[model samples]
Target: MIGFVILAIIALGGGIGVIVARQPVHSALFLIMNILALAIFYILLSAEFLAAAQVIVYAGAIMVLFLFVVTLLTAGKDDREPKENLAGQRLTAGILAVLVGGGLAVVGVLYPSRAIGLGLPHNFGNLRGMGVTLWGPDFIYLAAVALMLLTAAVGVLVLNRPRRQVKPAPRLEERES
Candidate 1:
């Protein structure tokens, strides 16, 4: 319970940091923090499979892709102040935030203990069972997905790579000059 509260604070702080970060990379890093905290929460709830998936898929692969895209796309860009002409945007966001917070607060008040896994099936999130299934009849699908992810990562890298800009060899006349 104490650990959950600490993690909740960290997650909230990371969420705020992601929103308030000035740089896109910083925002991505903050989002990674928030994601990892959520994964830890899953671990605390004994959802090992979810925690592993969250860390490996979201924090590892997705975050890497996000950082790569953010850095590569924004490379050599001039920093300019954003033109915020959306009047009352902040006011509207604040009101929505307050409403959402109130709803959550009421839920928390109703379920103070926040019971988890009330009617879950046996071995519902067991990692061993998932591995057996994936490696048994689902190996082909897993291989396909892995190939897709590899191709995507390669494509993003290729897109962001600097072109060699090779120049034609100087002609004889130009070389003589």
Candidate 2:
């Protein structure tokens, strides 16, 4: 219980840090920390496969890709872009935030407290169970997700590829000079 509490606090802190970080790289690192904490939670819940997947797919691949994108975009320095001046933007944002928060609070107040039940069978989190699910009717969805990721990675590579600048042949007079 204490460990869970500690992990939850760390996760929450990481989430907040991700939002509050000024640098994109710092935010990505904080996001990685959050992903790791979630993986730990999965392990604590006896979902070892999910824990491993979370670490490998999210913390490892996705975070690395995000950091690469951040570095590529910023070139390791803050690009001080001018802030946009939209009139009443902050006021509008504050109004939306208050509305969302108030709605959530109202829902919480109305919701009844009950002992939540685990909805899975005993072998739910095991490797075999995951395999059955992944290879079963859901295989097409998984394949589609994998394809999408591959496409995005390819897109990033294409975007970052150096273009071959075709320099016009020097004028004959300039060559002579």
| Number of backbone collisions per candidate | 0, 0
Residue-wise lDDT of candidate 1 within 1-177, one digit each (tens)? 799889998999899999788788999999999999999998887778989999999999999999999999987787576788888998899899989998997998788663553666566567876777789889999999999999999999999999889887768556643
* Model 2: per-residue Cα lDDT at residue 154: 100
Question: Which 10 consecutive positions of candidate 1 have the poorest summed lDDT?
Answer: 114-123
Which candidate number maximizes TM-score? 1
Backbone clash pairs for candidate 2 read none
Clash pairs, model 1 backbone = none
**Model 2 agreement with the true structure over 1-177: per-residue lDDT tens digits:** 799879978998898799778888889999998999999999988899999999999999988899889988888575565687697886798699779978986896689446336366757788998889889979999999999999999999999999899887778557743
